[model samples]
Target: MGVAGSGKTTVAALLAGRLGAEFAEGDEFHPPENVAKMSDGMPLEDSDRWPWLGHIRDWLAEQAAAGRSAVVPCSALKRSYRDLLREAGPVRFAHLTGSRELLTERIQGRAGHFMKPAMLDSQLATLEPLGDDEDGFTVDVFPRPPEIVDEIIAHLDR
Candidate 1:
C-alpha cells in the first residue's frame, strides 16, 4: 500500500505466490468510470473511491469465507480507506516506500497503464503512512521484489 509507482502490485503478487494465497489486483476492482477519470489525468475524489474500496473489501470477505488467505495490492492512500478494508477481516498492509525521484522514475518507465506519471504527485500527497497503531510495516522499495517479500514474510512471522 503506497503511491502509484511504489511496486505494490508486483510485490503483492510475488508475496501471494510465496504464501500460496489468493491474489487480486486491486486496480481491477475500479469501475470503468474511475479508470476513465484516471486516464484523463484527473485524481479521483473520495466519493469516486468508496464503492471501489467496498468491492475490494467484499472480495477479501469472499476469500475469507472460502477459508483462503489473500493478497491484494491497493493504493489505499488514506487511513480511512485502510480502516474500511479492515472491516472485511484481519488485514496487514505492507507499505512499499521509496524516494519521490525513484517513484517518479518507475512510473515514467511504465507503459499502457491508466495511472500516469503526472498523477504520482496527487497520490503522494494523498498517502497517509501507516500509524503505529496500524497492523502493518514499511518496506523500502530499493531492494528487489523477492527481498521485499522476504522482509514482509519475516515481519509477519514475528
Candidate 2:
C-alpha cells in the first residue's frame, strides 16, 4: 500500500501475477460518496474511511474464506487502518515509497482517476508508513514496477 502515484496499483498487479493470487484494487471498493469526495479534490477524514476500509476488509475475508491469497492495493495511510484490516486475516502489506516530486509528477500525469493531484499532500500528511511492528516491507518506487514486485516477492519468500 502507498500514497497516490506511488505505483501501488501497477506493482500490486504484478505481484498478483507473480504469486498467482487474486487481485483487488482498493479504489474499486470505495463507496460512491467517497469517490465523490476525492473527485471534488477533498481530502477524506478518518470518518470518511472506516466504512470503506471495512468493505476492503470484508473483501479480503471473502478471498481468504475461499482459500485464496490476494493482492490488494490500498492507501492504508494510517497504522490504525492497517490494524483494522488485519482483523480480516493474515495480511501482508507492500508499501511503495518515493520522493514528493516523483509522486506529484506521476499523479499529475494520470487522467480520469478520482484521486486528485491536489490531495497528494493530504495523503502524505496522513500516512504513517509501515511501522516496525507492521507485517510488511517497503520498496522504493524508483525502480521498475516488475523489479519492485520482485523485491516484494523476495521478502515474502523469506
Candidate 3:
C-alpha cells in the first residue's frame, strides 16, 4: 500500500490475476458516508477508518480460513493500520510508491474514483513507509503494472 494514485489497485489487480488469488479493493470496504466524505474532497478522520480497516481485515481472515490466497489494495498508511490487519492473518504488504508529481498526475488523470486529488497530500502526510520488521517490501511505481507484479513475485520468491 502507498499514498493515493500510487497504482495500488492496478498493481494489486494484475498481481492477483498472475497469482490466481482473490482480489479486493480497500476502497470498497469503506462505509458509504466515508465514501461521500471523500467524494466531497474531505479527508476522513481516524474514527472513520477503523471500521473500514476492520472489514478489510475480516476479508483477509475469511480468505485464510478458506485456505485461499488473496490480494488487497489498501492505503494502509500507518504502521498501526498494518499491525491491525496482520492480526487477522499472515499478510504481506506490497507498498507502491512514487514521486509526488507522478502521483498527482495519476490522480488528475483518473475518473469516477471517490478519492479526490486534494486528499493526496493528507495521504502522503499520513503514510509511513514499510518498517524493517514488517512482512513486506516497497516497490517503485515507475514500472508498468506487469513489471511491478513481476518484481513482487520475484521478491516473494526470494
Candidate 4:
C-alpha cells in the first residue's frame, strides 16, 4: 500500500509473480461511478470507498481461506482501512514511499490510466503513513523495480 504513483502496482505485480501468487489490482474493482469521479479529478469520499473496501476485504478473506497467496495493490491510506483488511485475514503490506516531486513526475509520465496526476494531491493529502504498529515493511521507491521486489521478498522471508 502507498500513495498514488509510488509504484504499488508495479511492485505488487513483480512480487506476485515471484511468490506464485495471484495479483489483484484493486483499481479494477472500483465502481464505475468511482472511476468516473476519479477520472474527473475528484477524490473519493469515505462513503464512496466503504463498499469498495468491503469488496476488497471479502476478496482477501476468500483468498486466505483458500490458502492462496496473493498480492493486492491498494491505497489503504487510512488506519481504519488497514484495520478492515487486517480483520479480513492475515496479510503483510509493502509500502512504497517516495518524495512528492518524484511521485508527481511518475504520475505525470503514466498513461492509459483513469487516475490523473491532478488527483495526486488529494491522494497525498489523505495518506497516513504506516505506523510502527502496522504489520509491514516500508521501502523507498528510488531503486529499480527488480530491486524493490527483491527487497520486499527479502523482508518477507525474514
TM-score for all predictions?
A: 0.98, 0.98, 0.98, 0.96
Candidate 1: residue 28 lDDT (0-100): 98
Per-residue lDDT for 1-158 in model 3, tens only?
98899999999999999999999988999999999999999998889989999999999999999999999999999999999999888999989999999999999999898888889989988888899999999899998989999999998898
Q: Which candidate is the best by lDDT?
A: 1
Q: Give model 4's TM-score versus the native structure.
A: 0.96
Q: Write the per-residue lDDT of candidate 1 for residues 11-110, one digit (tens) a residue.
A: 9999999999999999999999999999999999999999999999999999998999999999989999999999989999988999999999998888
Find the 10 residues in a row with the least total lDDT in model 2. 129-138
User: Which tens-of-lDDT digit does each residue in 1-158 have in candidate 4?
Assistant: 99889998998999899999988999987999999998888889999888888888888988888999888999999888898888778878888999999998998988878888888888889888788988998999999999999999999999
Query: Would you list the rank order by lDDT, best first?
Result: 1, 2, 3, 4
- Candidate 2 lDDT for residue 3: 94
lDDT of 4: 0.89
- State the lDDT of candidate 2 residue by residue for 1-158, as single tens digits: 88999999999888899899999998999999999999999999999999999999999999999999998999999999999899989999888999999999999999999889999999999999888988999899998998898899999999
**Cα-based lDDT at residue 80, candidate 3:** 94
Model 3 stretches with alpha carbons more than 4 Å out: none
